[model samples]
Target: MANALLLALALLAQDSQTGGQAAAQGPNAPPTDEYGYVAWCYGALGGYANLYDRVMPEVTRIEKAFPGPDGVAASLKTYPELRAQAQKDLKTFASAITAAEKASPRPISEYGGAQVKRGAAIWQGADSVSKARLAQMWMSWSPPGDCEKRAKTLETKSTILGKALNFNSASATTQAPPPETPAPQPEAPAPQPAAEAAPPAPAPEPVATPKAEPAKTAPVKAAKAETKPAAKKLPPIGGNEVIVDPVNPIPCAGSLVPAKRGGRDVLICKGD
Candidate 1:
């Protein structure tokens, strides 16, 4: 602890010397007192650290995990490359976290609503996971693969962690929502000339109403005619007026003669 304080004091002394020649700001920009900001940061970090330790100690376990001859390294790839990528991801995630912290508690507006919804969804998904699960991912699992995804997700939800770690008690200034961009409208179809609109097709010729055959004098007269038997002639008993038989059954319109052919019953038409 004494050594840590000594190191912090040395760093502060160096920062104080460097800040004496700090860069100038724009005419409208508010003047920043770097020493005041640094002092506040120091106090906030110290207070958060004490609170975090009390709630969950074992913080030094993370410090012991350095990739070297004496420390654990990834088995999936060359340790040097893995360690390098891990460092880059760590920095990238840290930047995303800082952005999140700066953008929290945004003002609600119709402008850029979709983006607001998207950010809200990402934060919601981040909030749904238990701290215990996150702790296991960070401290229990083997390194690489899913570790990158978990780290990126955690970075996206840094505001939640900041609050959980007791660093975000006072409300940050509400951020202005982004401006909305309108979707492009489709162009109207080119108008056709009056002649090109096309005239309605002519109505089909009225179907011919077939002349109704005067109510068919006979129901199926042609069929009956087709089935009628041919006339048979009896030996001419009496000219074309062949004698008529009262008992002979004939299928056609024929005269049946009792005078027979040589002596039997037969039928004959008027001409026969």
Candidate 2:
């Protein structure tokens, strides 16, 4: 640990000397080039370290409420001392990039270099607004991929942010709700067969009629007799002959007569 501190101090001292040389060249001389930015990747890692320090307390509190299986609490036990070291790191990194920018021939505006500086400063500031701004700047631009690899290496060597930076292991413990099971669909009703039409009513039975009598042959001697059609006879009630009463029954044409029949008084007709 002492040796690491010595190395950090030495690097800071070298950065200060380089910054002094850049000061002779003037503040607004030029922006940083890709090479200069790449050289400054160490400073960005330092910025991330400071950020880790600031959030450690909240992270600890969260673990207390909802513990993680990654032993984050145990890892962060030396946070106080690590935080102090991180502060020094932040300053050293800031100076490192400032010197790089001064020596760079490219303009700062070309790569949005101001945002990175602001992010570093904001991380040191440790205010809500500063933190938000830093997050925005980090999202706005990225350094070259190689620089990211360097940062990752730094994190691996870091005793502060170490594996705590990896949220994957922690996320694996919390299970997501199973995908919602779809409700069973109702089976469709079977199609019904079409109804058949009723057959036509049976034809009315045919009526029967009496056969006509055969025509009689006319006699040769009856040639003088005039032929006449026989008159049709009408059926009587109950097939009995009908009788009509006389218009006057006060006296018969032959004589007046009275009679009793069937114990009832009646007028008798004596006329031929």
Candidate 3:
């Protein structure tokens, strides 16, 4: 990603230079092939240089660590094929870098466009080289542990490369100075309070009043007539009952006896 950004900055510088020249020269200058070539170079260098640096070391490392199957040399034996591919990719990248370096500054847009193309090429080349390295590693080893480790390493490198590529491309194409946001308007001032007025008049009193009612009279009671003392009642004879206007039975010695009977009354009776 850092490399990509550097490439983008280079492209931007070139663009600024070209744009300034064009503005100074006015619109009549005839377009030149030099401009196109310069553009191509800018793109190419931005895109492929990092890939070359990263892949070369990885290729060398893998070739050196090549494990043999059946005690026979694996990677070293296959070096010719790997080396040929690497050499071809390297040549392509060098050519692109040369072209970009020689490219003259043009309009910023044109320069950015060229850089974008170059970035894409770099990404492709890097991917190819990474894949080739992985293939070489796998071909040289059959051990699961070794393969897993290599795969993880490859994944990490690839992820980093991808991020760098994306950032570089974005930086190259992104416009400078985001749109300005309008400042917020100040709120209107609140209304001021008026001076205090005189106090309101007191409410009028109600004329209606609740009257107290006269005390309630107590109810008259009829007086009971005085009666002479009643004479003692005689006891009844049967069961030793006492003689009274109303007789009440009472228990005595486990037998019932009347309270009044035959003008003679008995308090207790014996059981049979």
> Taking the tens digit of each residue's C-alpha lDDT, what string does model 3 give over 156-235?
54456556666777889985788899999999899889879979988998888879899898987877887756644545
lDDT of each: 0.37, 0.44, 0.43
lDDT of 3 at 75: 45
lDDT value, residue 115 of candidate 2 = 41
> How high is the lDDT of residue 209 in model 3?
86
lDDT of 3 at 129: 37
C-alpha RMSD (angstroms) for model 2: 24.2
What is the lDDT for 180 in model 3?
A: 95
Candidate 2 TM-score versus the reference: 0.25
Q: State TM-scores per candidate.
A: 0.17, 0.25, 0.20
| Model 2: lDDT of residue 119 | 29
N/CA/C clash count, model 3: 25
Which of candidates 1 and 2 reaches a greater TM-score?
2
Q: Show model 1 residue runs off by greater than 4 Å.
A: 1-77, 106-141, 150-272
Judge candidate 1 against the unseen true structure and give its global Cα lDDT, from 0 to 1: 0.37
